[model samples]
Target: MAAYSVADGAEVARQVATLPDGGSSDSLCAGAWLSAAGERQAFNDDFTLLAGTVPGPGNKGKTATAFSVSGGSPVSTGPGATASDDRAPVFQSGTSTLWYVTGDRHLTSRDLKQPSAAPADHGTAPGQSFLLAGDRPWVRAPLEVTPDQAAVAPGGTVAVGSNLLWRRTDPAASFAEQNVEPAVLGPSLNGRAPVPGSEAMPACAARLWFDDLSLLCNARNTLLRVTFAPDHSRVDKVETLIPEEQGLIPGAVLSPDGRSLAFLREWAGTVDLYRLDLSAGAAPVRIASLAAGAPTGSGGVGRDVRVIAWQ
Candidate 1:
């Protein structure tokens, strides 16, 4: 096996705002940054969603956005201008669709038919947001929900912050949000709410990876494991990997078989990667380390672990 210098590994450990695929990537600084020209730019694999935040009147800082992309981008269909503030996008395999959560606390999805360059090539308008309740949909969604982060199980079930879990086996249903009783929720990341000095950590249900296990950022500042079974039983266990007094953020990836897990921890203003052997619940093994250099300031966000691969 090959190893890299700390400097080289740091250079390779680039912070990506978005990962469109294994080969290509995009950055919000370039695509989503607000310009003085009053136009917004959003980049996806095939289409770049752009909108002019219509100024004044009822529009103010929002407007009816339009979609555009390069010639080779994916073709969008299904919804109309119903989706706004698309972030943390993830694509389901073998489908002409893209799944993502909107800032409105609704898990809305878009359908793509082919790749394109200009936004007009995307045919569908957009879809309204869906309420995500626990395994059930209500005709009326939550009117007052604002989520900072979201994660999807491998099986496509969606989990939000520590307070709510939502799943829809069929698209015909509405997404619903089930408020988890906080009195009994903890011992794992999902069981606790964000404490002082750690508002950056994602909520328990929001930090999940794979189908059930998720990275749990606990009140003691430790990375742990949280699992939700089919019967809706919840289990919280210490990860025993990536130990930090300040805790691990919501940026962990499980190996394909769930035996090995990769996670990032920020300590003393530096960030590093650690691996754990889950076969016997071994402690985390440090693999690569990163520090924020003078030019590229570095820190972790809720969904910072965009991609991970092994030889």
Candidate 2:
């Protein structure tokens, strides 16, 4: 259910998403929404650029995967021989960008609009140029950050671990650490009271609609809604809209009209996609689901399928 993100350079932009590990999940695939169906047709196995075409018998229902690889693979020069991790891919300014860490431990981005053998940089570690600060203790996980375009603070900051930090790349300054203020936690996300010092945020997407600021986060298998001030410096309140008890809510997208949420959930080796009406408070309605005998560790595990973008 986790999603992808976009990495930004000085004047360039790229989007990224991670394919689940081949051993624990399926193969490592990544891309963005590039076709008419509103789904991204990612290259299979490796993180190669793919063309939009019909899938073969072995990949029916995998509408996102229209065809095979169309461009050559990127030059692996960052962390490992291949990519150490495929972080979240995101869309911005009419482009979809994906990120990959190389053997040398550097974050690189690929532009799908114009495939590139060379990717730009943010810095070392996950939060260098990426927006959403991912929370991965096991291995550094990727949280594709979404900036509130209408109201991005001086530096886009998010709750990272016990502290808050900005995910901005500064060629002139080193990364600084900041903390979420106590006053900011005065209100709870849901109706329940917020446990003092217990609200540690995972990777978060802070989006803006006109002057309204809202955020989307995934924690303990539940999706979080935390709206903030116009400048995005402090937390206003928090709400647990999609309760974790339903299932693991990994990938989610707010509808363009801002009326509902489209998400993917996993259980019993199956991943089902659903839509929740945020305004009506109605139960989620099923949209798409994996067929029987589909790949394991899909959906919630973020191995194969993901919600790249929502319209």
Q: Please tell me which predicted candidate would have the highest TM-score against the true structure.
A: 1
| After superposition, candidate 2 runs with Cα above 4 Å error | 1-93, 96-212, 231-234, 298-304
Q: Tell me each candidate's TM-score.
A: 0.48, 0.46
Residue-level lDDT tens digits of model 2 in 233-294: 56566677765575556556667676777777776567776777886366766775643423
What C-alpha root-mean-square deviation, in Å, does candidate 2 show against the real structure?
12.2
**TM-score for candidate 1, residues paired by index:** 0.48
Q: lDDT per model, in order?
A: 0.36, 0.38
Clashes of 2: 31
Best model number under lDDT: 2
lDDT of 1 by residue, 147-171 (tens): 2233344444444433344444453
For candidate 2, the per-residue lDDT at 88 reads 29
Compute the lDDT for candidate 2: 0.38
Model 2, C-alpha of 164: deviation from truth (Å): 5.3
TM-score of predicted model 2? 0.46
